[model samples]
Target: RKGGAEMTQREFKDMPSRIARLPRDKRGFPIPKFVGAVDKKGEPDFRLVSHDHMAACVRRNLCWICGDVMGTRKAFALGPMCCINRVSSEPPSHYECAVFAAKACPFLSNPNAKRRQRDLPEAGEVAGIMIERNPGVTAIWVTRFYSLMQVSNGVLFFVGEPEGLEFYARGRAATRAEIKASIASGIPHLEEVAKRDGRGAMSELKRMRKRFDALLADRVPA
Candidate 1:
């Protein structure tokens, strides 16, 4: 949220109301919002991305991360690095987001993460997921992107996508040991969240860990 810009009053007032009114799926997941607006803290709170604005974004095939109309069709889908029976229904983002997310997002920055193909099935296969027809070249971050979804029980589902792979050279890569150490250090924080939240939260955290582990297992020894 650090690099987010300021928002206008009209956006501040309208987006939240729009999100509240959007229809929910059978599983109670609201449609994914096109996050163009943010709170005073520059965070994409639940109140962002108005209905009309999302419609316009879909109409123009805008970048989900930057909210700009894509200048080119060469965009990427940011999802989980480890496949693990997961699927991404999120819209395409700018190639720049792929680079930014790889460096800035925690899961994506992991060394074990690699690009892979994702099959976006027809809509009815999943309750709330939607796929883009004639989607841009399937690009992904070797690392992935994360999204927050509010479900029926008022719990947040942390979704990840690691498809449509793309990488940019910001600097030298971390050694495998360094990456492993970093992941090890993050475990306690996840455990704390699981303990504080409950079994459901713990289950989600474990699922994420499983995906990470799968990636690590597939890593060829250097």
Candidate 2:
């Protein structure tokens, strides 16, 4: 609609609708393939349309999982399910240094949690229980950028291609050391809200971390 913009009204409206509903990058309508990913002076790769076409089309946010910043043009169809599982956990979240509280504490019952028992015998169950209670958790798609492992301290962490992270908050996955570096790097400032303690932060933190470690099938590397 705007000048210099190439997206027609039909194309513009379709982008948001796709992003809001789709979660995986491999599935979606108007199914966009690698028409040819362009690495322009300032744009990310994976271009679907001409620059003018994209400029005209409003850009959509990326799925929390894949880190794919492109709009719905490359969105997947599963809606959070596929994307989250692709990484070490299901449901996306970014926080380290918080509390965790959840229902059932699956860490106490699951067998898959055994491998992670060195630090948490019930990690798997904890993740399952959390997923059971909070079905709307946001899982990250970081398997592409990090190495998941457990530590001798029994603490789980992820070593990303660029940074390691520790999930001091909720959700599942090996808390990567790179994530901790990111947090220390003022990531919290970029966050919309300041970290605060509430009725459930601790349990949720514990459960989510365990869930994350269980999903990775490895403990945070020491």
Candidate 3:
């Protein structure tokens, strides 16, 4: 009986790791680290989701942005993208955070920065950054799981699937409209940053405004 129990324990321990290896929807990108909870010291760790945390977040239905427990299973999966490539690998944030991030994130707001190629010295445009959602993604996946171990330094180490195996889809058109409105409302904040950071920030905002205007122009019935 003891041997059987030990075998069961081993299987249980291995179950999540096994499930973590399963394939996920590649169309949905991983959650970005910036969307995670800050540490006790108020610093963002920028760590990817472990299988354990993924399971915890799903089981608890926590909001990635506010670290608050959510009341419902339905949540928004926000993908921070530079053109087709995903830039973040965290988890599902609150609907509000998704809208705020889409509008306020510097990478998303600034067309040049979104498309800038870090690999090249000249910093040329490579892609446009945006928050994208596929109309097809309708649910979150939580079949996979992970385990956690706390080390001596008080840091928790995620042992499996830190890149995340679960996914969420972007919100609806109303949500997109809210994001655009938030961006428009944030213009003052951009100007404040320019005031504090000087020419660099000013130039960046100018470029973003130009890009935003161009985007608006493209949407017109021309």
C-alpha local distance difference test of each model: 0.42, 0.28, 0.36
User: By the TM-score metric, which is better: model 1 or model 3?
Assistant: 1
TM-score winner, 1 or 2: 1
Q: Candidate 2, which ten residues in sequence have the lowest lDDT sum?
A: 95-104
Best by lDDT: 1
Query: Model 2, range 9-67, lDDT digits (tens) per residue?
Result: 21222133333332322212222222223233433232232322222222333333222
State, as a TM-score between 0 and 1, how close model 3 is to the true structure: 0.28
Better of 1 and 2 by lDDT: 1
- Superposed Cα RMSD, model 2: 19.4
**What's model 1's overall lDDT?**
0.42
Give stretches of model 3 more than 4 Å off.
1-52, 77-90, 114-222
Question: Per-residue lDDT tens digits of candidate 3, residues 1-222?
Answer: 585653222111112222223232222222342223434465432332234555466557665544555553323433211101111234455444444444433343333343323232322211222232222222121212323343442222112221222222232223334334444554555566567988887887777577544543443232
For residues 60-122, what per-residue lDDT tens digits would candidate 1 score against the true structure?
A: 766555565565443444332212224334444556554444443323444444332233122
What's the lDDT of the predicted structure labeled candidate 3? 0.36
Error of 1 at 56 (Å): 6.0
Residue 112 Cα positional deviation in candidate 2, in Å, after optimal superposition: 38
Global fold similarity of model 1 (TM-score):
0.38
* Lowest-sum lDDT 10-residue window in model 1: 130-139
